[model samples]
Target: MPHSNTSQSKGLALPPPTIVLVHGAFADASSWSPVIELLLERGHRVLAPPVYNRSLAADAASVRSVVEQIDGPVLLAGHSYGGAVITVAGAADNVAGLVFVSGYALEEGESLAQLQGRFPGSSLADHLVYSPYPTSDGATGTDVSVEIDAFPSVFAAGLDSTRARVLAVSQRPLSADAFGETASLAAWRTTPGWGIVSAADHTINPDVQRFGYRRAGLRSVTELDAPHLVMQTHPEEVASVITGALAEIG
Candidate 1:
């Protein structure tokens, strides 16, 4: 492949690649603040694309919009449910690599519903939904408040009081349909992979994350002794992992 035109210039001519950070359900871009700062410190431009789980298809379009605005290579990553979105969002042209932070790495047509079917009575399932309601896409919606309650152990078990409080107030409603929708491609299959395993994650089982990432052929792995909010719990380590992934490609 031809080098980007700027690569031809002498010193400082190689412009930094853009690193797009996508947050998972029940939270927004703020989740990646610490991690994003670390990436910026290393001289890469970071883009945290905001998305809503209820708006699954719209999330894809929003991701596309973010990718279009950038002029260089993209290093895309997502936490939790956000992982599925980026698999579709950055799995295409120009995406250089991906990092999955305790996220569901799915294949085409696979939704959270389908995956959770393996074990339906986990804390999350028990607390979150009784039955689905109609959504804008003619699909079903869920009750997300139940998510925070059921997975509190997995997510905020060890968080600082201040951060934990913020988490409670910031958690948003994620749509039910997004979970059941499978990704067209596992971006990690094409893009080099980095997986963040939160050993104590309750919201998403740690074993599940490990299994999915291994199936994707990830060679670079980092384990955090945190809860479900892996990135939020230990952003510094997570940022270092992101930097490590860049070193592999750079």
Candidate 2:
């Protein structure tokens, strides 16, 4: 399922594509600001909504709400945990393409637990992960979350000192329960998609991201010496990948 030839040209036509931004755990919608801005500047409409930001279902519902506002085809994109959220949200009729920014792609019968289980010692998760809570955010199960220092060390690994600090403070704490939800659909398998591999990422290992990229059978793939937050660490490069995907799917 690997892509054959990756051209920087145009292909199919989606309904004036509306790019939806879904942020991973410990972050809100603003996590995609730079990338969203880049795409918007390029004449595309962007929808970066603040999903439940913690509750997986709530986040998916937020994505659905945004999708409802748009008129046609959408390039639903998610970062980190947001990837899982979009997998469900994009199942709708209008999702034309998908983008995973150092995000996870769950298999039809798998959950985040099983996928991460495949890469237990990935440097990315070891450093950033916090212990699951007895009742995180009022939940009744184990819910591991991130702390401030680990947040930057893992997520903004490629960011400048200033930006990383800002991201740590701005990060939102998602409900620990979101990761446990089983992904009901294999969105990547059924949809055209692409992934941006952050070579220097600390939150999610570069190697692991590549695994997802390859397994998802992306239309095209690109790697960058960016942080886990490639959207913020390398905005233009991230946008260019999206541009590349748009061209291929034009």
Candidate 3:
């Protein structure tokens, strides 16, 4: 039998929200592989889409497009830049809640660049490498990626050095505009939210992550002793928090 949006067993009702996972810059949908396994084991429908790291608005629109195809309510989750994408895309009507795994939750009119600088922990500015790419109008646009040597140490410190090195080599770079674009809407304002704070994160300061989560009024917050790649380093922990978020809205 097909699963309905709501299920009844005994006298209680269960909410079956489709889980949509979004990855941040320097990554693709594969970043959610670990977490996907856990969510599926728990019987939740999950979708992890490729978010082209070109511009914030464009990435958000890509996420929105994926959400629109789902047949039921969604629990949208994002990491790093992915968090910023969901903040803009989560405004969709079918979105039920949001999960931020060491992700940014920018407010209206705020850019990820501005939010990262709000606190003093991130070393991203010092490690970034930029290249020029042709834009729609024939002018050049900046593409940003972290130095290969800096990736394992700065972005994935919580993971093994070998794995981090591989991730660094295969990482995707985001357009400079993605970091500078101001968010049009903050979905967390009206949607229930959950946050996973990577205590040892270097990409985005842990303090900034906490502030974003607090400012958004997240219903639940989990602090883990991990780095920016918290979802990868601590997938079970990340999944636990996501499960909690799902329970809250149900």
Best by lDDT: 3
Candidate 1 local distance difference test against the native: 0.72
Query: How high is each candidate's TM-score?
Result: 0.84, 0.83, 0.92
Task: Put down candidate 1 lDDT per residue, 106-128, tens digits, no spaces.
Answer: 65666666665654334465556
Which candidate do you rate higher for TM-score, 2 or 3?
3
Clashes of each: 10, 9, 0
- Candidate 1 matches the true fold with a TM-score of 0.84
What lDDT does candidate 2 reach at residue 104?
80
Candidate 2 clash figure, as a count: 9
Better of 1 and 2 by TM-score: 1
- lDDT for residue 149 in candidate 1, whole number 0-100: 45
The local distance difference test score of each candidate is 0.72, 0.72, 0.88
Name the regions of candidate 1 deviating beyond 4 angstroms: 1-14, 119-122, 129-143, 147-154
Which residue pairs come into collision in candidate 3? none
lDDT of 3 at 78: 96
Compare candidates 1 and 3 on lDDT and give the better one. Answer: 3
- Superposed Cα deviation of residue 133, candidate 1 (Å): 8.8
lDDT digits (tens) for residues 1-250 of candidate 3? 1123333323444446899999999888988899999999989999999998999999999899888777667899999899999999999877899999899999999998899878885777789999999998999999999999999888878787889999999999999998789999999999999999998888888998899999999988899989898888899999888888888877
- Model 2 stretches astray by more than 4 angstroms: 1-15, 123-143
